[model samples]
Target: MSKFFIFLFVIFIHHLSLAQSVQLTGSVISGTEKLPSASIQLKIFGNEDLFTYGFSDEEGNYKLSCEISQSDKFLLIAAYIGYQRDTLIVSRTDLLKQAIFQHNFNLKEDKKQLDEIYIKAPNAVEVNNDTTKYNVLRFTSPEDRNLESVLKKMPGMEVNKDGTIFFKGKKISKVLLEGDDLTGEGYKAITKNLKPEFVEEVQALEHYVEDNLLKGIINSDDIVLNLKIKDKGVKKIVGSIDAGLGTNQRRMLSTNLISFINRTKAFAFANHNNLSSS
Candidate 1:
């Protein structure tokens, strides 16, 4: 008789646990569009202790089973990236009265998240102090062979037929190679010859002053272009060569080579064309 009583007590406890458990079902949507992979979470209302969690299916349907305690209320939350989070308050008494509680989330687009995306976009331009930086890879394509080709596609910048660059309707005074004034006023020598693949960033400096002593004393209106090269290795070699043979045994050849090792830089260029005004 004592063994029978113990068995009955075990069955009663199992039934009590089942009676205290509740089922929660919901669907996540944005307007009429269902939001798949949305996260669903349930927590105690007052102390905010997590009780259960699940994720929506491809059809945006979610179901959660949680055990109810003596707490009077609980919180249900639905969340997704790029969308506003939704929360619902549920009562323990109501959960026990009904076997399943139904709720739906109508999430809205989050403007703050959109703003973050705009700032982090690949083509996003950034201006810090007097310098404006451009991501070289953003405006460059596979067809682009030289740095000049990428500059033409950048906004607020233009390249002339002679390979001169202009920024914001003002002619750039000079182009700097890795912060060093190597080419001086004849920047086309580097801009036209350097490969776009070797460059990582292009920066434009406003009111550029070449002399360090006259930096704050002299007020200048000059725009300068700076090329930031990519770090490939301790020593990097990048260049291209083109050779063509036309009619009458006419020949054309062009070659360019740029080398950067540590703090040293070297550039070499050669062009020969036999096509002359006959």
Candidate 2:
């Protein structure tokens, strides 16, 4: 009977220990103002990949649930783009309490890092009326091949496998090239072929039909992307050509030509494979 009671006590103690969990809540700020979308991460001390990540809301409020019952100490990291990262070393007492723990983080602007960036204040992301413009050169890496590759690096833009594009998790209806419908509404045509060096800035706008009768009454959530061309990138003729003959009477020929000058822009492509076109 005594052994049975001891076993029950141990089971009860195990259940009590399992019931304790930490609920972490906090706010991120920068000089009395809330910082939205700030990244929050938690990792155990002296470990490799115990990372738990979340982001602050628009009001800088954040709530994180950490499964640190096994551990009593860890590190809390908070960061945002263009800001210095901040960390907190959580002690054992904070976890033992197992209640809602409030831990705030304060971040400072990183001016030196900002200065090293390619785009400065004048060409950085800025809003004018209903349109937001961002300099493409700032977001591009040296190895980026085309506009599609650069778009994936930029914030708030995503390109899916089926050529669908999204902005801020919302679907975009149109992708235009210099205010005109080039290659129709398919995003990958221009996105894959257009050279990243040929673009200067990217403009994002909420587009709608401009009829006076349906101006504000009709609700539309259509978003469009426009690539602004640079004078030097488009003022010259550029293309590539390839022809080869292989064994078994195999022949391959492919060509691409692009020209954009003062009032004329043309693109021609031809490819010959084993498949018959006749």
Candidate 3:
């Protein structure tokens, strides 16, 4: 009887291991051409937790592994510069030995016209409005160093020493990344820690949030900061190092590095300050 029980336990363990080890293989192509360096992210559907991820190589090929249960559904997100985002759904049955899936995408360029047309009773009026647009480059420079420092130089924008951001004499109530909140400590943490190079554009929205009853209830006085990141910017490696000495015998060194491949982004930061030597 004991031998029979042990046999069943061993079989159960083997099946469990197989269930936890699953592979996802695919290639990213843009308009029939391979798109090297494209990013891929995998996540359990309806769950914020990240699953396994991988990036396309020089030949636009990628593979990933994830521990999946029978009930877990998956969502695969692929993105690249100048290309529209692509998402795929995977199921348990999709897992077969060395299964290969092919994904091809076409990237569309974003273009807009600056002129406006208005129709009147007898004629149409064409107006060209000179609008001021603010992009991350317009407000940031290599000398600014960090996101907080760059925000201070933006017109009608301010950042307090405590890391609070304000615009046009009104405190910004919310900050969003690709329209999603940053989770905890939210904007405060992002502005203080994120490198300015990751930012692509800053859009100022007035009366940002609206409820059914609050229609036209202008919070125009209130502002929200929307951070738009470049599609390519998130998938590349970026970092910085700074070391300096002051006249008062103070020394400082700092370093920051970030890398994104596929849907995975990793970052590291360190700083050191010393004034007394033994």
lDDT of 1: 0.80
122, model 1: CA deviation in Å? 3.8
What is candidate 1's CA lDDT for residue 103? Answer: 92
Candidate 3 lDDT (Cα, whole model)?
0.61
How far residue 82's Cα lies from its native spot in candidate 2, in Å, is 3.8
Q: How does each model score on TM-score? A: 0.49, 0.53, 0.39
Best by lDDT: 1
In the range 153-191, model 2's lDDT, one tens digit per residue, is 655566887767776556777766676656656667677
Compared with the true structure, all predictions reach lDDT values of: 0.80, 0.71, 0.61
User: Tens digits of per-residue lDDT for model 1 on 1-278?
Assistant: 99999999999997786558789898999999987667677878988766776667668898988678777888999876567889999888877888898899999999877765555444334556677778887667789978999998765577989988888657999999778888788889888877887788999899999898999899989999988877645688666687999899999888877678896787787778888721
Query: Which runs in model 2 stand beyond 4 Å of their true positions?
Result: 1-81, 84-112, 118-121, 210-217, 232-278
lDDT per residue (tens digit) for residues 85-137 in model 3? 68878665665434454444454432231121111111111111211124665
TM-score order of candidates, top first: 2, 1, 3
Candidate 2 accuracy as lDDT: 0.71
RMSD, every candidate, angstroms: 24.5, 10.0, 21.9
Q: Candidate 1 or 3, higher TM-score? A: 1
